[model samples]
Target: MHTSKLIKDTPTDRIFLFVLYIFIGLAVLIVLYPLIYIISASVSSPLAVNSGKMWLWPVGFNLDGYKVILQYGDIWRGYMMTIFYTISGTMVSLFITIPCAYAISRRDFAGKKWFTNFMLITMFLSGGLIPTYLLVRNLGMLNTVWAIIIPNAVSVYNIIVTKSFFQSTIPWEMQEAAKVDGASDFQIFFRIVLPLSAPIIAVMALFYGVGQWNDYFNSLVYLQNKNLYPLQMVLRQILVLQDMQQGSATGSTISQSAAQAAFSKEQLVAVIKYGVMIVSSLPVIMVYPLLQRYFVKGVLIGSLKG
Candidate 1:
């Protein structure tokens, strides 16, 4: 009898739920609108794009923007460099961070508290950019890939999170059992702990990978050679050059028809910016879903107990 009353009450609750869902849908559209505009603008002709004729879809679609971008051989080189950096940097970061986190997670380790405190101190303080630059210069890492990867190999925040996860999730008894089986520390870590700790490791890998992939500031600071420049730096230069050439003072050098052509070129460049973002982000974005099932459990298990 009470179940029927509750069922009747659920209809009123569902009405409110429907209203809430509608608001959320509107919010999603608002967030997605700019992305939609960028895609549409990239495919649309310059005239249609600049005139604000594009809505949610392409207007008189064209591929000239992609053609122009692909014509630059430097962009292809930048793409390859970025891929290499992202992969190598993530691997190096994980190697450093995972071991450090694991060591800290063990309560029996002497000076673990002091080490953890030292790491926490780094999170709040730094040697600053100039000092770091000098250090890198002294190490002769400048203009090399190590300048980008080695300096940022161990993030304190990531270390803390990962350590917490390990402490909270991995049982001490398991390590003891592995040791009883004559497993070395390294063997136990790799054979037992690592397999069980997949979620947090995956999370850390994603964090480090994305950070390295999107990092432009490090490349800008350390890399002097254009040949060593990553995709972001190249993109920055392309945008700046496009802006300068399209400026009013420079526009006067060209005839009216030429000015129009230049404006079209500018629009195409603007569109390509969005395309580049899409291309660069697509891999990481696609990767997350495959690991998504593990993310929540990993975070929860790793965070709560530690």
Candidate 2:
């Protein structure tokens, strides 16, 4: 007969584990409650949302918010614009970032130290908003899709992560052997390095794609045409109009008919705010799962390696 021994925690360890579990539970509640509330409020009747009657669950069920958003023409146009920006911008960023990081990762690349230090320094400091705006203006990129995609095309942190991945993961001997076999640098890089770098590439694409998808600040600042506005900008316009309506409803005296119209509009807007949250966030939430396997592996290998 085989004897078995079970390991058990002492009183002190059990108490510490209990406290940690309690803290973790509190943290989860803090993060989860807002998401629950937003979803509940989005589907609830406008009046219920406005009156705070909807809490953890929806009250006075209604689909008017979704109906309105779906019917809005500008919402669809902005949706297409956002998709264009995300795809084009991610392509541009990745193209610039990958080769630059690979170049800096190689020991034989001249002045690599100086270039790396320059990038690291830039990570700490930048020419602030005004100078950057002037630069973009001088480039004649304003009001164009270029403004959304060009100005912030490359991120230093991304370069660092990619450089780390290249340096730590790729064996220098492989390149040396390729060179000995009469393969050119470009040939070896394209044929071998890229094939092996799928995980990091996926990770980079996820990061850049998500960033571009959510970006509205660039559109708000650089774009003047309604047609050029992205989804977030279009949604922002709705939210702002709602705020203006609220101010007029409460602060300014109006006729009974006008007052009732404003009240109805305000209620609808309140529900729309929550509905928009779910809509805007849903894309990113859905995309993350597709790249999640590569995300953890890439980040860990790139970050943990010397």
Candidate 3:
């Protein structure tokens, strides 16, 4: 090993680096401020939140907002519904996307170019919402969980990313060796390709999971039944309508207590609103840490390949 002498940065270089760090610091603060404010508001006393006592940290810290939000039965039901939709939808999406991407990545596959063009065409062109809704209705999928999960299951964008990953990350030489050992196409894919494709799979799971979790528009359009409503829809109802149906359903004991709280009902509702937003988003937040290591690598490799 050779040791290299250190050269100090020139004054001009030092000045530029300092300026760059300052700019990056300001950008980070700009992004982090709102997130901190939301978390502070969610935990702060209703009066503290409404009076703007909350800043970077919570003032008059209390859990009343969370307590009130969690008291709702519908919130729990919505949680269950969203969990089911996220898991089931992600599994379905991965099943379709992974194989399709792998197949398209293989040079020997027939109609590869045509299939790629077809997927791209659908990506740019859609039948629009009206036709999509009509199609779902005609298929008798409307008002069911299938309407929410099935219509948008296979994302063309994901297919492209996964295909790029397979092409770049999985070596053709490995597949050839497997074939030489009398492995069929299916055996090679299952035994060899998939094992080497964990990074992309994790990335796809994160993408699909987050998309399905955050989705509410599909639920609103396709599912009229409140029982089938996902967390986002339920949160919307609570935030917008200030329904407090949960408290009322539990009887006047809870309702009277809520009314007797330190802050007025509307102010308290405002506090609960922030808590609901945080609660609704918590799952996706938790998921990010697990997939973050793979996300960048997967995206970079997948995008850079031919």
Candidate 4:
């Protein structure tokens, strides 16, 4: 009887909960609406797309844009190159960051403080772009795939986050017990520490994977060979050229037929841009869900406790 009365008296709480859910629903819609519109516009005919006729659904369904973009062989090559870079770079980042973070997390290690300071300093300072470019040139990494992968192998922020997680979550008594059982430092770390640190590792993998997958600036700066270009650089080029082609060629002395042809080509290119985004980003986006399940737990567990 008391419980029933308490439940019945919670009208104010119910009202607040209803209002919170409504706000959350509205926020989700606001975030998802642009993505939905983009997907719809990509499939819609250029005439329907440009006239702002599209809403929640495609204005006129057409696959012409996708067909035109896929006809270009270089885009496929760029896709393959990007895949290689993202996978290889992520592996290198993990190799460098994991052990380094583990070492820093241990309080008793000699020179640990100095090492931590050195890493923190890097987070605050770097050789400017010109110096970095010169260094890459001197190393003969220019125009090669290595330029993109090697220079960014370890991110300082990621290292700090990883170290914090290890320190906060991993108990020292566990390490001592492993040592008592005749396990070497390497065995302790690999067999015990890493196996138990799945959440943080997943978080780091997602971070490194996303960074490598989306990287384009370094490729543009160092790589002169078009064959070595990542998907992002290729997409950027396509979008820029597409926009230029779209601008009015009316005042120019070009013939009427040429002007009309240019306009049509530009419209086609505009549609292709949206299609390219869908193609390039979809794979990376799909990977998020697998990693996302670990994100909240990883971040919460790994954060500094004191």
Candidate 5:
């Protein structure tokens, strides 16, 4: 028979905890409200959204926004394109980033300091837009699939994080042991290092995937074919075209039927914008939960080690 003693909080500790909870609760509300509002607005009727009647929850709940988005044909093509970009680009990034980070993290790797310093210089200084554009053009990457994929493949920050994770988390003794067993460096890396690197890999994948998914500037600058445009660019074009139509309608005289059609289109666009927001963010939100465990562990350990 053992009795467990309860520890009571002192007044100072209690007061500190109370204030801390309040601040934490406020922070949560600040972050959570926008997400809730976006969801609510996406479901609410266009009139309710535009009229400001929809606040914290849906007002005059409707699903036509989603219907209109579904009917929009280009969005599907853009989705396929975006998915391809995210998957392929992430693979390319991981392939380059992982090997480079591992090599740089190794103490025996020759000229590591020089290589790291050269890479670091890129973080602050770079050729201006014209020079970069010319370089890409000279390489004939412009207007090609590789235009976006190759140019933004390696992230220096990701490399640093992964390097720190490898240096601190992976034991140098383990590598030595593997080497003594008559395993070559390549074999040891392929067999041991990669297998234990899932957390950092997942974090890198999330970062690179999200960046590729949301990327539109590269498409705008380098891509010529409308068919090559990703989901973000497609959405932007839709919004721009709608605005143009509205401007034309307002500036020019139109018949009753035309006016009615324009007004109906306006309402559809209003709701569709919010629906698009939900649809665009849905993939990332779904992915985050899957990677949450790895993300937390990787970022924490990597950051702490650095």
Candidate 6:
């Protein structure tokens, strides 16, 4: 694979590769710059951010933004709720998705094709938001944790990926061997197939966990109780409505209050905005690397063959 070992590229090929590298480098900058700016802005003084002093690095660095955010009792409650939802949701999704996928992958399973088609149809078509809401309400799931977890317990896309992975990675020979040993289908699945499916399981866990963590729409529709709000919803309230209100109140006071207090208020909001962005995204960023090794392998193996 080394360039020195490979045959020399033609002039046209060289030029194409050079252009491709430049394009890729530009794309990286486009994506990376915003992340760097957010981090820098979060740590910078509010005045520095408001005055456009921060670019690549924090200016007049301070932790006041984080200090203010941590002081909010609602944020802590939201954090706990999000953690509970993510853990519980991922467990439920995996238990349902994995076993169902394994079953559909089995060639001997009766009506597997019909089941797959039914799942696919549901993927493309759903009762609209109103009907779905009414069902949840009638089921008494509204304002409950199940409202967020049960309705989205299984993703058709995940099932497809996992089924494809099982088909490609686990062969019929293994199942035949297990059967020769007098193992039932459930025993083979639980003892043998599950052990070999670590990579796909990790990938599904990451996907489902991130979805649960980032979900606010479900909470918005089903949860009228502020106590049940997830971290994303709490951050949305802080970054959107609360920030606007704070800015307006500060602007009104600016005309009557001392110059220092007015300046501090403006800068504080600027810092808090960036800080909130970082806080909201930090958990996903931290969790991704733990499962990254399995992610590419799972997606490629699951998709390439099927």
**TM-scores for the candidates:** 0.85, 0.91, 0.92, 0.85, 0.88, 0.89
Worst 10 residues of 4 by lDDT: 249-258
Ranking by TM-score: 3, 2, 6, 5, 4, 1
CA RMSD, predictions in order? 4.2, 3.9, 2.4, 4.6, 3.7, 3.9
Candidate 4 residue lDDT tens string, 155-255: 88888888888887889889988899999999999998999888788788878888888999999899989899888888787777632345433212112
Clashes of each: 1, 0, 0, 0, 0, 0
Error of 5 at 76 (Å): 0.4
Greater-TM-score candidate between 2 and 3: 3
Q: lDDT for each of the candidates?
A: 0.78, 0.83, 0.85, 0.80, 0.83, 0.85
Per-residue C-alpha lDDT of model 6 across residues 217-257, encoded as one tens digit per residue: 99989998989999999888877656347664323342223
Q: Candidate 3's residue-wise lDDT over 107-169, tens digit each? A: 889999999999899988999999999999999999999998899899998899988888877
lDDT score, candidate 3: 0.85
lDDT of 5 by residue, 64-142 (tens): 7676567566789899999999999999999999999999999899999999999999999999889988999999999
- Model 2: clashing residue pairs? none
For residue 174, model 5's alpha carbon misses the true position, in angstroms, by 2.6
TM-score, predicted candidate 2 vs. hidden true structure: 0.91
For 1-306, candidate 1 gives per-residue lDDT tens digits of 455433364787899999999999999999999878877777777767777887779998776666556656667788889889999999999999999999999867899999889878988899999999999999999999999899999888788888888877789988988889899998988998899888888888877887888888999899988788788877676656643366542223222323445554456656666656665566777887887776666566545645
Best by TM-score: 3
**After best superposition, candidate 4 residue 73: deviation in angstroms?**
1.1
